[model samples]
Target: MTAAARYAALLQWLRSNDADISPKIDLQPSSRGGGYGAFLTEDAVEGELLFTIPRKTCITLADSIEDDACGEGFKALIETAGPGGNTVVMAGFMARERIRSLESQKPGSIVDDSSFGPYLATLPWERGMNNQEHVLYWDNKDIEKYLKGSMCYGEALDLRKEVDVAIRVLNTIVGKSIREFRGDYLDSGFQWPWEKAAQASEEKLKGPPEGLAEAVKGAFVCMLTRAFEDGDGDEEKLVPMLDMLQHSDEPNISHAMRKSDGAVEVRARQDLTAGQELLNQYRSELEETMPYHRFFTRFGFVPGIQEEMTNLFEDKSSIFFAQKAEI
Candidate 1:
């Protein structure tokens, strides 16, 4: 199918399954188009399972590249995903298939079936604007040298194919959620606190997706907001999945990757209360500046005196109390 047709089909599939598979989430839109959060429905006790999102559902840029030469030990890494392989493998296969088909009639062509030329040609240029800025691009001379040094003609061809398939798969599965809500105005049907913050701020407050600000320079707030807005709708869904855990400087819920299953799981490190807000420290206090600059700069909420007081007696006091009530 054509790329446009394939995209339509994917969107249809998401919309059809929306009711059955949609996690109990509340969409909170910010002044910026894509700023929102997802909250848990029922109060979850500590160590409770908030949710599980399969890696297949979320796509990343690395998933698209067919170039095994791009990284060392690439073949072994691809084989590790098992027999059917993961999306990365699929991407490689697809890239090869496209390259092969083109090469059949054009044997002398520099762009044969094993090449990533076709897949790269079809990449969504607009969506990649932000990513291009972050990544280091290879010049033709560098690429030619690397490709020659990395593998034989046949092996290079195979790697390019794999890269194509991976990129396609990543684009297909990751952005499903956000695409569904595009072009719609904010709705109260959802009850997200961040949305409330956006409303409270008269839609002026905007923040980056969790974790992004720390990972990328000048990527703190507005850049993330725009990236999500421009990203494949499916990829943007990942934000809500992460947001559902809520926010805590000292999070009871911890993010962990289960290597055995390749699934990212949120496990309770400590017991929790039903109404207690779930939180994961977006930036580590130990690693970053005091009071966590990311939180205050992005969320428009700061750790107040109450947080300081809690820190002072947090170890000894079972419950935190405000100074006004201490009298």
Candidate 2:
């Protein structure tokens, strides 16, 4: 199906399943930024559904790449994008023009298209907004870093070989194939609905083929196991909904997920007044260096750095490591 058709169908499905909540949502352009997020019209207590966006409604980097091996590179890039093991956990809003251009060109091929021809021909290009290319280039550098790093060496490799084996087996069990789209460059800027397309393209760069949920679960399991081995706790509990909530440092809501069925229940972390926008922190408090920096690094939003504004919670107790060591 064409990208437009697929998007329309997905929107229809969302509207149908979310009949009660759909009307409450205002998907119109956000003057604050170029992306979309949910907001509450009235007071909602803890454990409320807020709104449930179907899995199909969200997008992932895996959706754009054609090969499963690309995930290894992508994961590595994510890791390098931040400090040691505490990488930003949410997917960033990929620039629409860059994504379209990347998809159009064959991997490793020269840019035969015009200087601007390589860009996505979306409406934003016609307007005055600057096409952000640095983010993509940063991701590429991280991928290269991962390719060079090794988890094991020589006979030590034999001891850790099981992890690699597990990852390989999981890959086979949860493989996915994605379709590619060609990028076309047009005018530098445009208006209205055409601009909307640029926003959507950033969110939905590519679509996933069948079995993405299974694939995501399997990958999560493998990563969670490793985290546990490294003194990270029942990290398994955090895996399922990690991707569901997008990143924000100053989150308006707090959430707890039920592991049995991967159900996410959100609650207002603080008292909120009417017309107040809702936010949810995508990563653990221990990892975020500053509140807004999370938005700037991950979503490309300009949240100036402030050392005083660090993540609110941190468990300094060594009990977590002790528990993992006992395991």
Candidate 3:
């Protein structure tokens, strides 16, 4: 399906699941170059509601833990791996659902559908928006080449290692608990770095499908770039519709989890005009000002960051790279 079809499907899915989307707001190709963003279809005053996504429609750790297909595996993963593994479980569940969605599309496989298939289908990674890739998906060599001596580089390396560890641990857990995730589900969906490297090197390894690791990493990339705190607590969630808004230094909209109904609500921070692109502040400046390197490393791009701020780090990293090369 084309991008427009996917967006339409998403809207349909959202409404079917009790999500309240404002007809005044629409999702469209973003001018910010991040693939997609929300735009205003009608003029609105400050604090006007843009949308409200029911909490159940939001992908959260609790929902992952209770999933029918992989809940037991997730329970075991979290119990064995502790709190940090919660993120892994969420990503793994999403990956599994995504894999299921793909399988359903194959000939003679109509039963292999995911409950959250439409939302998963709209994710940037699933849409082949390579430019929207998070830093965690970048090759280790490329990360070192560009940012070796910078603080972001170290953080990136650490995050990569963490993902590697999660992959190994989750693989073992899935092998022991989840039957549905055993064979093809583990081996298909989402290309990983190793798969990319193998394709680049023209090397093919014949064996059991090892794509589970790839699937998890792919979901992690999506989670990293899109998920946000639900305002209920530190538990982050992937809220549909709200996540489609592009980031801007001066945001026009803000979101909060409604205490009354457990819905995620988006409201205009300032008066909005018809045809204006909706923008969100990914992080709160009042809480903390994110540095350029950290923002770039975390979200894969530093949208709205000053050119000089980014270039200063690039110049420093270039000097550091040259100095290390001399060694």
Candidate 3 contains a number of clashing pairs equal to: 2
Ranking by lDDT: 3, 1, 2
Q: Model 1, range 159-209, lDDT digits (tens) per residue?
A: 335434444333232222112222123556776898766663542233322
What TM-score against the true fold does each predicted structure earn?
0.32, 0.35, 0.81
Give one digit per residue, the lDDT tens place, for model 3 in 1-327: 887888889899999999988888788888776466788888999999888899888888988888765688789888887888888998877766776677778777645577788888788653237356466666767676667777677778888888887776565444322334334234346788998566424322322134666677778887887898865365878988788778877999888888887788889899989999988888754435466556776776765543433354567743223344554
Cα deviation at 22, candidate 3, in Å, is 1.4
Which 10-residue span in candidate 3 carries the lowest summed lDDT? 200-209
* Residue 72 shift from truth in candidate 1, angstroms: 16
For model 2 the TM-score comes to 0.35
lDDT of each: 0.35, 0.33, 0.72
List where candidate 2 sits over 4 angstroms from the true fold. 1-11, 15-23, 53-134, 137-248, 283-327
Point out the higher-scoring one by TM-score: 2 or 3: 3
lDDT of model 2, residue 273: 58
